[model samples]
Target: MRITDLLKQDTAILDLQAQGKEAVIDELIAKLNEGGRLADSQAFREAIMLRESHSTTGLGDGVAIPRCS
Candidate 1:
């Protein structure tokens, strides 16, 4: 599925403060939870982590596409 499909308006952060990939992932999860997309913060965090493990979804040019099933 497209990343935009999974990206909630309230959860999609632009120019996040995190310094690394993991931190950026955590920030996304937090935003998703805050927006009530996931059941809880932990579940949201895990979902992003699992997706990243399979492949680097970064589409290059400083753009990253993250999706969860």
Candidate 2:
């Protein structure tokens, strides 16, 4: 599947209220959970946080792509 395929109206946030990276991740996880995308939100959050602990996910210019499998 493509990124566009995964990013749907239900999962997309137009005006994000999250402040920092951690908050953003939490918000996104919640969004995915509400959209019925994530099977286990806590597990997914833990995996993402583990990946983040190894290194930064911030790309640059106030952008980040946090991911885990």
Candidate 3:
């Protein structure tokens, strides 16, 4: 799906100040929660962590795809 379809001004944290991986995830989740994209942040966070445990999202292109199932 197009990111523009889901991403909006409210959900985009252009000035993220998170200092670490988990922290960044938390910050993004908070943004999504604030934007009404998630009904349960903790549960989603757990899922993302579970997925991360399988393998790193880093693609060696300075980008990471954080996903949860």
Candidate 4:
């Protein structure tokens, strides 16, 4: 599915205060719960974490693309 399709309204944090990977992950999880997309959220987060463990998804321009498996 498209990234936008998986992103729920609550998942869009226009102004996030947390800084760091862990905080970001927590925020994402919270958003997923708020959006009522637990299944999709868990799958997506897991994929991101796995990929991050192998290599950074950071594209070097301050952008990261986390996808769902």
Could you say which candidate leads in TM-score?
2
**Tens digit of lDDT per residue, candidate 3, span 1-69?**
455755788788778899778988899898889888887989989999999998878777556768865
Candidate 4 local lDDT, 9-63, one digit each (tens): 6678888777798677768677767887676666667777887788776777656
TM-score of 3: 0.82
Q: Write model 2 residue lDDT over 1-69, tens digit each, in one string.
A: 356755899998888899988999999999989999888999999999999999988999978878874
Question: What's the lDDT for all of these models?
Answer: 0.74, 0.88, 0.82, 0.70
Ranking by lDDT: 2, 3, 1, 4
**What are the runs in model 3 whose C-alpha is more than 4 Å off?**
1-5
For model 1, residues 1-69, the per-residue Cα lDDT tens digits are: 455655666777876888678987777777766787667678766776898899987998777866666
* Poorest 10 consecutive residues by lDDT, candidate 2: 1-10
lDDT of 4 at 40: 69
TM-score of each: 0.73, 0.86, 0.82, 0.69
Q: Which residue pairs clash within candidate 4? A: none
Poorest stretch of ten by lDDT in candidate 4: 60-69
